[model samples]
Target: MTHRVSELTVAESAWCKSSYSSGEGGECVEVATCAAAVLVRDSKRPTEARLCFAPEAWAGFLQMTTGH
Candidate 1:
């Protein structure tokens, strides 16, 4: 199965760095949520490519990672 994710500009999305990231960056990630999908990108490389996750999948991943 194939899923489609809309490519969005940084300004277009309300991007926020993960709270888990520290000032001294080491493997940091940023995320933004939209109507269609959740956007994720490397905090260190703001201009790089982004990975999109479907809303349901994103929520499931979060729940699993956080052990909720």
Candidate 2:
């Protein structure tokens, strides 16, 4: 399925960044949780880039990243 992140209302979504996100916000990324999906976006460019993934996929990514 084709995922068009820009189609979604990112501003309305509550995006949260990883604790590991750097203070510079240059390489930092933010995440937003939704009922059907999770959104990953760049903190530096909130409206520029975004990636929307299924909840399960996002959870898997988070688990792999957090290593819990």
Candidate 3:
């Protein structure tokens, strides 16, 4: 299941930028882990909507992306 970040109480410090990010502001994203889900938001617009994914689903996504 997925939820919006607005529905959860995630701390600002919890967000971490992707290592692949150039840090020069080029389509970067941030991720945060919570008890119920893993959250994703645009690095440039964090206050906007954020996508939350179940832990299992997030693991699956990583596995698929990494092909490992």
Candidate 1, 6-68: lDDT as tens digits: 444446458888898877968889898877778898988977778988789999999999999
Q: Supply candidate 1's per-residue lDDT for 63.
A: 100
Segments in model 1 whose C-alpha atoms lie over 4 Å from true places: 1-6, 9-13
Indicate the residue-level lDDT of 1 in model 2: 50
Write the residue-wise lDDT of candidate 2 on 1-68 in tens digits: 55566656655548888688667745887888766668887787877767889888877987998897
**Highest lDDT, which number?**
3
Better of 1 and 2 by TM-score: 1
For residues 1-68, what per-residue lDDT tens digits would candidate 3 score against the true structure? 55666788778999999999997889989999989999999999989888888999999999999998
For model 2, the stretches where C-alpha displacement exceeds 4 angstroms are: 1-3, 10-13
Q: What is candidate 2's CA lDDT for residue 16?
A: 82
| Candidate 2, RMSD to the unseen true structure | 2.4
Worst 10 residues of 3 by lDDT: 1-10
